[model samples]
Target: MKLSLAEQMREMDKKAIEHGIPDIVLMENASIKSFYQILDAYGDVSGSLAVCFVGAGNNGGDALAIARHLYNNYCDVFIYMLVPEEKLNPSPKTNFEIIKNMGIPYKFVENDDDFDIEVINEADLIIDGIFGTGLSRKVEGRFKKAIELINDSDAFVVSVDIPSGIKADSGEVMGIAVEADLTPTFALAKPGHFLYPGRIYAKDVRVVDISTPVSVIEEFDPSFVAIDSSQIKLTYRNPTSHKGDFGHLAVVGGSTGKSGAVIMASKAALKSGVGLVSAVIPASINTAFESHLLEAMSYPVDDNGGFFSENSIDSILEFVADKSAVCLGMGLGVTESTKKVVKAVMGIEKPMIIDADGLNCLSFFVDELKNRKAPTIITPHPKEFSRLCGVKTKEVLEKRLELIKEFATNYNCIVVLKMADTLIASPDGKIYINTTGNVGLATGGSGDVLSGMIGAFLAEGYEPLQAAINGVYLHGLAADIATESSISYESLMPSDVIENINKAILSFFEA
Candidate 1:
């Protein structure tokens, strides 16, 4: 689904109004849809006590209308207006008048002292509408107190649009944010609803269509999308096809102590439905690969003290010459000789996925990425990305979307910024946010598995973007499936994720 930024949503609303949908109509639709969501969650809110915290924006207007609907349904409703009635926006001002005429009990409060703690604690539900997508500053004063009270209470909370105080575009929490049990966003979900701290705050976000014209939304042409099963297009395997019909994948990386990384990567590649898989490693660890990898082949090259050296470059290049795609850098020690080999492999005209220590080597000379004519993909966590971009890890986390896009556009490659919420950026500036996988994937070898999966897809003739998206989504989905089964998050391993790849792929067909 398309994920909109705050500005894009505002422009969509403007275009909707221009297309003959009145602003009031949209408000009513939002309120009514949001009310139904409440009804769905709590079947009989007829006699429930609801305390609504209202601000001076359209989100407050939505709260007022919902409070009126609750009152009409025989519920006891109380409105705590943070701002004076006169300060409300035009549409919200109209809603405030209607509630006042209907005798909905309300009080103007300046701070936390005026709030009735007993009533709030006793309330069955709290509707949060103190702020909306336009919030650019930290929340304070009455609004902060209200959010604190709502969070402190046991009452079920519902937020309008997005959880107040969460930045709509970046998901950054402004000082404090409302922790809602549910958030009914209108038309489309904002990036904040799915990104980091905001996703945690805006829990169980449900998108409500408030009659924004389809044409208006399409005209906006949002660039960000959430990766899900609906976006996965799995190719049907021909029953008559042989193993060679799929494609061959080459896994190239391994040093003395990190040989397990290449083994895990090769195993994941074979599990990803690749026709054939091979690993090129230092000769000292060849026995380990031969013992662990049964279905895949390994080519051991000359090494200096069990680490890759310049002597292995010609042999490595010759071994991977016939491979369909190459997965580079998993446990490959970052040294001068290995860096030379990495550079030599980059000149080959095959789709390449660089990860782990490969990224570390590339960071030494990132401009080499622009010299490659073949498709290139780099999977880097924040720290690795920081090295490539010459920024701090904190800055990489803060400006990941922008940095990844800029790198992809400039280097002419696909960039996958791996994090809790993995972001995939194409050279064309399109971004796909993956909201799969759990804390279980925070272990070692996970990234290695991801590289192999993507390499397998690329070898199978999937386009660079599609391969990256599918690999990322399915990689997380496999971990999710493992955790959902007998495996606990603490016990979940990269090998377990590889084992569940078939199940994850089957889930797409099942859905």
Candidate 2:
């Protein structure tokens, strides 16, 4: 589904209003849809006490209208107006008048001291509508206090649009944010709902249709997308197709002690349904690959002692010459010789997935990426990406979307920034946010498995962007399946994730 930024959503709303949908109608639609979501989550609300934390903006207007619906259904609804009724926005003022005329109980509070914490604690439900996607600054004063109170309460909370205090575009929590059990967003999901801390707060997001014209949404043409099984486009295998019809993939990276990295990667590629898989490793680690990888072919290159050296460059290039794609740099040590080999491989005219130590090596000559015409995908976690971009790790986390997009555009490559919520940026400026996977993927060698999965897809002739998206989604889905099948998160290893890849793919098709 298309994901909108705060500004884009506002523009959509503006265009929608200009297209004949009045602001009040939009508010009413949002309230009614949100009410239904509440009903689904909370069941019967006829005799329930619901505290609506109403602000002065359109978001608050949505809460005010919802209050009327609650009242109509026999809910003991009370409105806690953060701002005076006179201070409400035009549409919100209209809603306030309606609720006031209906004789609903309400209180205007100017500060934390005026709030009835005991009453809020006793309520069964809290409707958080104090802030919307337009919020960009830190929430303070009564708003902050209100959020703290709501979070402290045990009541089921529903936030309108997005949880209050989250920066709509970045998901950065400003001061504190409301911890809602459910979030009912309008039209499109926002970045804040899928990105980190905000995703944690937006536990369950239900997109509500507020009658925005399809033409208006199409005119905006949002570039951000949330990847799910529906977005996956996998070709059906022909009935008579042989193993060779799939594709050959080369897994290139392995040192003395880190041979398991390449082993897992090669196995993952095979599990992903590649026609053939090969591990190009140092001579010192050839025995480990030979023993661990029974199906994958291993090409042993001369090593300088136990690590990759310049002597292996020629042999490495020759072995990967016929491969469809290259999955590079898992456990490949960062040394001058390894750097030479990595730089040489960049000249090859094939799709490449660079990860782990491969990223460390590329950090030295990132400009080399700009010289390549082939599809190059760099999978880097925060620290690795920081090295490639010559920025601090904190900065990479803070401005990941902008930095990844700029880097991909400048280098003419695809970037998969790995985090709790992975982000895939294409050279054309489109960004895909992956919503699968769980904390179990935090283990070591997980990225190597992901690189191999992506390489297999690329070898199978999937577009570079789709290959990356599918690989990421399936990688996470596999981990999720593993954890659900009784594997504890703390004990979930990359090998376990690899073992579940088939199940993940089956689940995708079944869905």
Candidate 3:
């Protein structure tokens, strides 16, 4: 886990200073890295043109320093300091004087008259240095005008560290943020660079080492984790193992109108390497799985057509006898009888995943969830999570790490808080933000499939956290592979996701 985007920079700078790395040298290293990124992306710019937007703070220093490098490439560069000369700090003033001494064209934007929108528009690239990770307030006045002008320009824009006007810690846009075609960030990718408005604002992101030592990262202890393709590949199953050794998952859910929920989970379970999958649903679905699900065995539970009743508990218990894991929720209707059945199922001692309606049931039975001997996981998409937490959806979306840890500890189960960036939080406060899924996974029945995938990992012997981390990573990775047709999130369906699970899984074992 790395500290957040803002905190990461702060810690890096703090330690650099502590180790006696002068502020100017650190600024020089960062500026050169920024300079290198621009050259790498756009290639040699000898005899080219660039517009550098600088602020009065040290942020402006980075732009001034980079202006020197662009000059080295024989480019006509202009440094437009958005702040008045009187407002500039010592470090920025020192750099500004150096740029003037070097005879590089530069000026301060006193008003709209000094605003060189045309000069920037005519340039090959615009470098954003108006605000860095330290900005915590709303953008207004000339700063806003400068940002708008640079954005409207034809020049391919590149942001330093983070896109201006976006909060590095919370990833919220203060007012209006700069949209960059490429953002060269120092140290580690900021939370904003990866989160909602910032993620969208940061068109393309790259992290430069900047000499932020590994020892410093360990000291600060970051709450966030970046999931990579290489790590998922590391969790591969043994090729020599038999089918029975993989795992067995019992998927329980689906009603008349909701039959598709459990169906997707079963298909996902089988596709993710669970050898034995017995889907116990309303008797109506047995035929559905028989025709639609080739590999999954359907166990018919007597139902009143629309929901599961207490009567199925005996047979459901019997179905769970040899299964290594159980996945409940999905289309299981929120009926009185179904509630009782969910309660009865939770009391059984086996590894279980409570999802969809199952999560709703567990929210009412915290004591049962905590007392259970089995390793249990509860997967809740934002809306479903709102129901369990009894709070507004915004609260969860805004302060995800806090809300997830609170719920996971209270219920004594691993909580997978699903959204655009899904969070897997454990009772011990270990949180991992899933880096895989795209917007294409925002459709119905997606959570059900994810629930089954986690259970599949659990039955195969991964710990609760490992199961959750691996499951979420795998589910999103699968969706990324399935986007071959360039399907947008709105048009992507759960079935489309199921079709790619094998490809996603095999990618882990590929030579």
Residue 434: error of model 3 in Å? 2.5
lDDT of 1 by residue, 160-201 (tens): 999988999888999999999989999988888877878789
lDDT of each: 0.91, 0.92, 0.81
TM-score of each: 0.98, 0.99, 0.93
Q: Model 1 has how many clashing residue pairs? A: 0
In model 2, the Cα lDDT at residue 173 comes to 96
Per-residue lDDT value at 244 in model 1: 87
Q: Candidate 3 — which residues are off by over 4 angstroms?
A: 1-5, 218-220, 233-239, 486-490
What digit string (tens of lDDT, one per residue) describes model 2 on residues 50-109?
999998789999999989999999999988999987889999999999988999999999
**lDDT, candidate 1, at 3:** 85
lDDT sort, best first: 2, 1, 3
lDDT of 3 at 480: 86
Top-TM-score structure, candidate number: 2
User: Clashes in model 1: which pairs?
Assistant: none
